[model samples]
Target chain A: MSGHSYDAEKYWKANLRLIFGSLIVWALVSYGFGIVLRPMLSGIPIGGTDLGFWFAQQGSILTFIALIFHYAWRMNRLDKQFGVDEE
Target chain B: MSQFAINIMFVGGSFLIYILIAVWAKAGSTKDFYVAGGGVHPITNGMAIGADWMSAASFISMAGIIAASGYASSAYLMGWTGGYVLLAMLLAPYLRKFGKFTVPEFIGDRFYSKQARLVAVICLIVASLTYVIGQMAGAGVAFSRFLEVDSTMGLIIAAVVIFIYSVLGGMKGITYTQVAQYCVLILAYTIPAVFISLQLTGNPIPALGLFSTHLDSGMPILDKLNQVITDVGFSEYSADVDSHLNMVLFTLTLMIGTAGLPHVIIRFFTVPKVADARWSAGWALVFIALLYLTAPAVASMARLNLMTTVYPDGTAAEPIRYEDRPQWVKEWEVTGLIKYVDKNEDGRIQMYNDASDEPGTAFQAEAEARGWKGNELDVNRDIIVLANPEIANLPGWVIGLIAAGGLAAALSTAAGLLLAISSAISHDLIKGSINPGITDRGELLAARISMAVAIVVATYLGANPPGFAAQVVALAFGIAAASLFPALMMGIFSKRINNIGAIAGMLSGLVFTLSYIFVYKGWFFIPGTANLADTPANWVLGISPLSIGAIGALVNFAVAFVVANATDEPPVEIQELVESVRYPRGAGQAQDH
Candidate 1:
């Protein structure tokens, strides 16, 4: 433990913040834009339909993929910054 | 080769590949059997996870569900895929860092209570078993339709094939075999979709083609579809009839349940590092999105194509004569999935909204004027994906490929789920709790036996499926969403949640979700035993049973917090363990103890 003064608590806090942030986006794209706020988004058309339908069918899933990768990439960087990454 | 022969060749060749992989990857130890010796590359594990996660439902039935339900069915797409986001952020990496073989093992060790582990095992078994029944049923349907055998006989064949690979190689074999299955199923799914897309909109990308203009109608594909369906008295293709709350809850339940499922959870355990666990979740969705993105295109296109086949000239044109229906309809008719009643005996198929409660007076007058008695075509929704290639008149090889793909989807998922059940019984029950001193070899034998038994049970249930079994599959997600997910997430995230609180929360969630479903679905799913009809009108707070898991999960979290506050906190050492799991450091060194 002495070899690494990584501040594990601080690292954990950063990770939680990242998770919380990403999850908000995750919820917004899928449940918010896709379902509840769909009518609000009906004014913005994507192709043949409104933005909400695109979000429901296509946009949310693509966003989810991007979100996971972003989280993974950021968390890995956070691990390195805190000097807690695996050797 | 003949289409039947081609189908046999493709299916038989895929099984041969599976058995060969099984032999190549036979597990030498429990470690190998359980988690592929914990050295699987993230990308390989991602593909395996893709195959493992996309069960018979995703491959065979999802497009049909989407096609039938229109906009409302986006819940399945969003719910199923959105769960990976939760898994990646909330569960997978932490669980991988925890370094356990089974989901229940994580719960047992984390809570430091064998009783909690046992409760988790029961939850895993119920969810996995219920989920596997649907897989076996899907496998049976694929086999019977393609092989021209009775569904029971088809199920037996599927059972034997699954038992051979899963019993022999365990996770190691299933992992590689699943990678192969993923390729087959994806190719099978996408090829037809691409062809259909090109035919309809001249767009090679099915996802894009879904929104492109219908070439003949010169209107956006969806707009044309809406007009055609609406004119025939069917709900508009893009209409949102479900209450927005139920839709949100249903999607949330599915997302959480997908994140919680034991089988999907275990795929992360096979990856070596915590970071790999995170990356693998992303890759798995990338692979899954390939099919999921195409599924909507397939659904919408198939619906449009079927409509054109019936009408030919336009919606107002005369329907296809019963005697002149396409070869695909005749072929599917033999399987009893598509039936034509000809209620008016007018020699033309009358397909429209047959719901007695449809209150559109103008539509009713139009139907009466056309001499349509009621909707004549009793087409099973599950048949759409299977019938897609045939309906589109794609090459025979593509049809053969679909048969293989559907089998791959069903078999891969069934194997993954059976492995989950078998591992829980052997590792969680026998080794972790009942007989701690059980030898590694004895445990492996126990695992194999349990897997064989699972196959028989799944097969038997598929053969004579319970009436509620189909609906219960959705409830299985509800149970997982309510029970296992909250317990596991709380165990990882909340150090104050002790064994009592965890168990109490799980039991409450499980019981609450189960009883709510049983109240409407039937007590224990015994047909004719339901206290009330499973209708939205009878629902509490207008929440469909399928969507109640989200509420059940809320109940779980509340009960957990209240009980944790009222009862003892976890030991300090356990709190430290939770802290260690949250960080990504030293994950590579954490071996399965």
Candidate 2:
């Protein structure tokens, strides 16, 4: 364990943060944007209806794709930072 | 080609595709049978999970349910996709990190008790068996309706096709087969949706078509559909809910329930890395969203078509003749999912909400004028998707595609369910604890035998399904949500939970939820034992038994917490295990394939 070369603790904490952070965002958009916040968002016009309608229909879907890719990238970086990178 | 020939071509062609893919990937070892040797790529795993997730309910019943219910149906869209976020965030990565071949194995090891494993096993078996029954039945229903085969024969063919693909390749084989199934089912769902959307809204994209104004009429398509439907005495489209509390709870329950299902959870274990399991969930949601996005459109378009067929003239004019109903109606009636009874002496099919007692509503006036006694069209809501292509007068290929899509949906999940059941039987039950000295080859043989036996049981149930397809799905969901979800969520989140507490929690949830259902439904659904009649008033607080899973989950959490505090904390290593599973770094190993 010389000079923290096996920095498992630090990298592990960072991975947890990323997981929790992405998950909170994930919950906010689907349950938040699609369900609870849908009515308020619908007040702003998209094409013919309000923004909430779009969120329920299309916007939530786009956000989900982004969330997945973002989580994948962050975790991969975390893996490397901890020297657990798979070759 | 004749409609029958067209149906044959569509359904037959899809099966060929499934076989071709299964041939490409042949499972050899026990690892391949269980977790695809833990070597599937994230993207491929994502697509396979999509096929596995979207079952008969998604493919056959969803669009129809959405179409008939209007705004009240938003529950399906929100509830189904929301669970995926829970999977990606709360469950998948950690489960992969803990890294086991089966879910019961995870529970057994995590709690360090065989009792916990047995409890988890019971929950998994109950939920999965109930779920599998519907898939087999859906296959039978599709075959009976279109292929003109006997329903049992349809189920056998479906079971055989699934067995060949599933037994031949195991999880590795299933992963590839499911990707193909997703393509066929999505194409089948969207092609007719595109045509119908084009016809009604002059928009090819069904998702966009949902919100657009009707090209032939000035009002929004939804607005117009609601207008006529209300005029005919039904509730307004997008009408306010009967109980906001029930709707919210039901939706929340479904989300939690999906996250807890063992078959879906095990899909994450097959991925090669912890992070891949997390990402795989998101991709699964993306593929599911395609059909979900189209479902609202399909429902809207089908509703319009049904209305137009009902009222060729304005709503005030005479309806279509009951004797000379359309081909779609004729086909569905043979399956007994849709039936017509001319309650009024009039020959015209006077469709209305014959149940409402509201004064001055058009329904009352119409019913009085026609001397109608009650709601006469005995159509189950699930018939909407299967009947859509014929309702829209699309070519026979679309109808056949719907048949194939239904089978694909049923089989995809069935394959996943079998893997889960067999994995639990051979790996967790037989090898891990029961007989550890068995060789891998011996374990594999046991797994295959369990899977084959499960298929025969599921097929028999499907051919003579114990209940309606939707009813069976609700029972399965209730069991999964109430029993398995709380235990699993607590396992990772709460380090204080001991083996005794976890077992107690599962048992309490399972008994409470099942007993509540059995009291209302039959005793083990044995027909005469349904103590309470199925009705809103009969339910506690007008909460449907289907919605009772949320309460069961809450009971589970409370019971487990109290018991854990009263008992001792788990030993130090288990806490460290939780800490390790929390992160994605240094947590996964690549299998030697």
The number of the candidate with the highest DockQ is 1
DockQ of 2: 0.32
Worst 10 residues of 1 chain A by lDDT: A1-10
Best-performing candidate as measured by TM-score? 1
DockQ of each: 0.67, 0.32
Q: Mark the regions of model 2 whose C-alpha exceeds 4 Å error after superposition.
A: A1-66, A81-87, B321-338, B357-362, B370-380, B467-470, B528-534, B587-593
How close is every model to the real structure, measured as TM-score? 0.97, 0.91
Give the alpha carbon lDDT tens digit for every residue of B224-319 in model 2.
787778777887665545775566667767788888888899888888777788778878888888898898888877877787777778687878
Instruction: Write the residue-wise lDDT of candidate 1 on B1-593 in tens digits.
Output: 78889999999999999999999999888888888889999999999999999988899889999998889899999999999999999999999988878999889888889988988888888888888888898898889889788888999999998888888999999999999999999999998888899999999999999989989889999998988888888887777656888889899999999999999999998987988999999999999999999999999999998888888878787798998988999988987899999899999988888675764557878888888999899988877798888887888889889999999998999999999999999888888878989988898888888888988999998888877678844677898999999998998889899888988898899899989988888888888888999998898878888998998999999998999889999998888888778876677732546
Chain B TM-score for all candidates, comma-separated: 0.97, 0.94
lDDT score, candidate 2: 0.78
Span of 10 residues, lowest total lDDT, candidate 2 chain A: A1-10
Angstrom error at residue B122, model 2 = 1.1
